[model samples]
Target chain A: MRRDRIATDSGRDVTVVSRNGAASARDAAAFSTRWSYARKRQLFLGALAAPALVYVLAVAVGPMVQGFLYSFDNYNLIRPGSRHFVGLDNYIALWRDPTARSAVINTFLFTFGAVTIEFVLGLGVALLMWRDDWFNRIALGLLLVPATVTPLVVGLVFKALLNPEYGMIGYALAESGLSGPRGLLAEPQRALATLVAIDAWEWTPLMALILLAGLKSLPIDILEAAAVDGATAPQRFRLVILPLLMPAAFLALILRMMDAFRVFDIIFVSTSGGPADATNTLMIYGVKQGLEFFNIGAASAVSTVIVVCILIMAAAFIAVLKPARNRHA
Target chain B: MPDRARLSLLARRFAICVVLVIALAPVVWLFSIAYKPTSDIFASPPTLLFSPTWDNFSSVFRYFNLGRLLESSLIIAIGSTALSLLIGVPAGYALARSTSPRAIWLAYFFLIIRTVPPIATLIPFYLLMRDIGLLGTWWAVIILNTALNSAFVVWMMFAFFRAAPASIEEAAMTDGCTDFGAFIQVALPTVVPGLIASAIFCVMFSWNDFLYAMFLTKADTKTISVALLSAYGTKDISWGTLGALAHFSTLPIVVMMIALNRYFVQGLTQGVH
Candidate 1:
């Protein structure tokens, strides 16, 4: 039933149950390497890739698939399996409803607006920090603070600072020529925008760090050549820098966009998508319907749609990233 | 290389200093609120200078019981990170050593998983955790985080271990190391940096998480992230406790990141590349 083949430190033993009868696979890989390059590399890579694969299937794919399928059935968590096939029922409900539409739009708006601002701000900051200098110490320390704090705290902190009556934001705004007690999230129109700004403050550093690394790795010759050609600063930035920075910028955009669409913690704490559902993103709606309302089928539908959207986005990124991956391969 | 370069560098550094101030203003304001006397919190000009006191800090620690919440957070953080590594390392190793096409799909699936929103199965996961008798317990959050973040660990560490030399394991094997033994005795010790990086990230995600912790947990099982939020985000909140806990909540991460800046930045950049 068991092979007591290996022991670790602390005397904890690991059973080596040989799958397909190759001990460690390295021997097989070694044998193949001498005779067949492809076989050896594949085996070597396969071994390296297997753990991540298992994790994806077990924790990720299983739920995503089940969640998708559950959409087709009117499966309620409270009442497990009454099992009626709703053909496009949830889809119709979501599309036909205005509230759902607002949430979906808000989700995309949050993603696009927040990530755009963050990318610009991040690039500006990263460019400022590109050269080695004294700013490195304080800048690194300061910029890194926002991303390091837990999101929930960020939400609460912003909630306090932005609250009217006593919050500092109200006092500051009054000092600035604005009227009294503007609900950053209390007003229906400004609620989503307010949440978007919070995300920008929190995550712009991510964009900066990525761009800074990319900038660090750029070949200096091109920039020097541009300067020698008597290129102006803006001209050099627009032509030489922007094109080269596309890869990292696009990568940050994709990442930030993905994260922004899933805005939950801050919205949950700050506005709860309030003042007429202006700030409610899909995640919040999913939580409200699925968790609070116990409508698993509708939630499943939302989950399925989200998966499709993510897949589409990921497919585009894969195309973007494919060249780099192939070069590495 | 000359005065012009020096000037540009100085200008660049000044700009960076401004950006740094902008980035850190919100967090610094938290401390300002924490240390300022209640009467001085919202003075007309907004007092930037004040005598610091322990009243707020003491209240946060004692009355708010941030200490207990910190304990809860530490346990869950360590538990999730450990469990993630435990499952992830072996799984990553298996992928690296195996010759299966399934590995490709598995790795891609992990990537896809990483991209998908966390709320996709919030209700179902809650129901499942509840079904399994794990709802509202500390283990519930630990297991949830482990499951959620283990894929990231496996993927990142897989690349690390895959790049590892197989000869050490081969030499160990011929000299009486078993399959698992060759890995542990000969391989794992050298991969500590990767493991440490992945562990830090795992801790970061599990600790930073608010949604799952908020939705799946009760008061006793609540983490410091929740504590931090409740102080600032709720209707019953006050500025004094919010600032104090904010200091404590952020200090650990800031210290860790500063100590491991290179590793932290490198890990972050790797996600893009």
Candidate 2:
């Protein structure tokens, strides 16, 4: 019976294709068309895609080119009338600038710290909520709150909480003799760590959700087989699950790392890259150069460095994880 | 063995509860502060219990012109979302249906564009907007945001469209429907859920943006995020009013997430799968 149905389906397909061929040839002859049907279809697809491609080129690609140019020239927003080329001056200046050096170092420190902590915490929570149940569902719903809140709001909320004078956490810590009077954000030594903590607080939920999805989709047969073979839970996870989970883990890491490298809003509102520039990452430094100092060239240069750093990091991540991914596959 | 397994399960449940509480504490604290009276705001070891007051809310509205900022935010968010969808949905459909290698490359191009940090484009956008005299206007913010969001929309909708079956559209075309007509009539309705999900994400990102809004907008067109930041920068930081403003800016997004919780989760997990 299945073979008979398949024969009829093929007969229908052949008739349909012949009908389409006749219709297309007639239509082409009537219109004196130069393009084939497939070519026309390709043109239609290209036309459909043109608008977005044009917009991205104008807004993203064009600016990227202009930003590259701006980095090498003495382009200042305030002194727009007196623009001149100064090849590599801004880059050279950045190398000599202590603040730029500190910004680069601080950016790495913050990204590394935040991504590592968020991954570990996110994995832990994901493991805890691996089972699908009413309680776990509610917990996951609650987890979505932090990730959904605006970063700016998170920054403001933490700023209020960590206020050295009468803020709740600050007061509690001071009273308990755990911190000094300056509090976390105000202390030069602790402000960067505080920024990392705040970032982790807001984004660890996102990491958890992604990792949870990974855990949920993991092959259960292998896990069960290992269990039946008398393997311990830790041994099973370490030997089998961890290798399979690498792709998801790497994805979460790359995303969080890229975002962490561009850390701006939270640091902008909470510390303003201060308690004496302790938390001045590349983003804040770039904005300060452009808007605050009106050093557009230097700002563009800083942005160039940031883009290069991100690309290198992403390339490194893909290189290291590709082999693992291939092995799993 | 069963007893040990049950004990481990209980510990896992406890840990989940702790994680949830930690995740929610800051938001809860902000809400607490927003409703507290000015006197209660600075009480040593901030007061958790107080007579709820509308004073902060009133002050935020009365002094900050938060209503206008809210309107600006709404306009920019909705405008960007609409523009992104208009430009992205068709592009996404085309890319999904095209068997050309160039189409695949174009899809990857959009993904790469999505990864370029907004700061990289800030200076040029600033300069170009100034040159065009679009500085400090809603159109400038809307256009730039639309540009940013279009990449994301295309990326996401490409996935959605790829997952949708091609046979249905092909059947429509074979039944005398033009390609565009087939896409509009047959392909689009199937991806309504994906469209809605992508729209929500676009709105969320555009509304929550701070850096671009901060640089691009002037006093008249300030978004709530930038307004809140400026309010914080004042020497005499009014904690109560700031909290109220924070709540005002965040409540809509939180509510939307809750309302569309399942879709939002599905969107986040879609790429992973």
Candidate 3:
């Protein structure tokens, strides 16, 4: 008997019997057993996956497509029946508007500053907690508490703590004349930076958690080998660990960058995009247009811009970090 | 231990303590505010210690309808999580067991779905809900959340189910078990931790979400996070009330974090790999 093998994409072999007879008879035999089995399997898989695919397409993709169309029209909810399409005018308006321009700039600055600091501080924290023990475990749990707090609440906590007249730290700093008379948040020049610091504080713990998880996953034998070769701790980290840890670092950085770019909850509650528009990010601007002002078209335009920015940034990150990943592999 | 080694250990412990303090201080202060007398809350030079009170908690109850808010949050979170898991886990298994090369790209498509800016979809989703007569209801929020979260669940569980061995299921097949039976009995049991991790993530994301909740929910269906928004209004600036509400909002997830610490770490690292 001769056996025929069907190869799967994953390289698994599914064997079937090959028969000698009239071509039609042989084809019928194959269809009844092997071909039907493969067909059944594919149909089963497709059936399993179809629900989620359909749900996302309907609930998520449908609205996204509608929103993209809305971006081209002047569809202010407040003005309901007077809607009209204006080709690329909303995008042109975003360019001309100084606040929108500031928002775009602020968003970039916030993402870069917060994500960089979080990555560095997170790596440091991860290193400190590397020597698994009872104390470190407890510390790890405690440290993640900040991350678990709602971002809006995080803003509220900071706002209360940084209130100039009565806030503990804010009062002391203001009384001692270290900070500005009003408060850190009240000063235009310092407000965005303070929010960035606040963003770092709320999120650094999460960054640390992801990086620590990554650190724990690093093969100990490789590190030990590096040590046995007489490399110092810093040298080993630079040469051996960093290269191996690129994927985790890439993950952590991308996660932070995505969230930081959109940086809404804290900014919404804390600054409301303001002290002279210092912290007006794309999210804040978009929400203000869509929700507060009911300018759906303008809001959709702003939303589209943000989505495009995120896509470009994600592509850039993949382009830059994927090469490192390929090299590691 | 040698002197140098002992010193290094001490330094490490001390550094960790510092990290802990910086990490927990804002949170501790927020919690402390709920217990402090209203008078002491804003005292210039800030009283180091004062009599504690439950007035903030009482006020939170009076104003916020604490029970109703918590119920809404629980419904939205649990509803979205259950639905996501139902649709997402099966799809993840399908992708993982797939023989097609295009399956990996489909997994990446789900990843990209997660990064879709909320503003992009949320506005139209809001209009959609309004048109369908579901706006200001928990279902409105639940449906939108399921869309985003199921995508995430699909991606994460794909990574997990991919990492899991298919050989066990194949053996079960050889032993006369059906494919579906093997999946339920053998494959599902293997990825229990992943399933739990994905559920935890879904719950956290849904529970902590403010944007969708704020947009979709009305006075009757407000979640705890949305309630916190009212507490922190520009005019009133009720620190005590905000703090008290914050306790309820943060505690459940915080407890979940500590309880499922192992899976949290595992899910994150595993998903990446």
Models sorted by TM-score, best on top:
3, 2, 1
Q: Of models 2 and 3, which has the larger lDDT?
A: 3
lDDT of 1 at A158: 82
lDDT of each residue in A1-329, candidate 2, tens digit only:
22243456555656666678876555445333323555677889889999999999999889988998999999886888889999999999999999999999999999999999999999988888899989888788778998888888888888878876678888888778778887888889989998999999999989999999988878999888989999988998799878878788888888789889998889988888997899999999999999898989999999999989887766765565456545654
Question: What TM-score is obtained for chain B in each of the predicted models?
Answer: 0.89, 0.94, 0.96
lDDT of each: 0.74, 0.85, 0.86
lDDT of 3 at B188: 94
Report per-prediction Cα RMSD to one decimal. 7.9, 5.1, 3.4
Pick by DockQ: 2 or 3, better one: 3
Decoy 2 TM-score against native: 0.91
Interface RMSD of 2: 4.1
Residue pairs of candidate 1 with colliding backbone atoms: A47-B95, A47-B96, A47-B97, A47-B98, A48-B95, A48-B96, A49-B95, A50-B95, A51-B91, A53-B106
lDDT (tens digit, per residue) of candidate 3 on A222-294: 9999999999989999999898787788877986787788879999998899999998999999999999999
Candidate 3: docking tier: medium
Task: List runs of model 1 lying over 4 Å from the truth.
Answer: A1-56, A75-85, A178-180, B1-3, B37-51, B65-67, B93-105, B159-191, B230-237
| Model 2 score (lDDT) | 0.85
What is residue B134's positional error in candidate 2, in angstroms?
A: 1.2
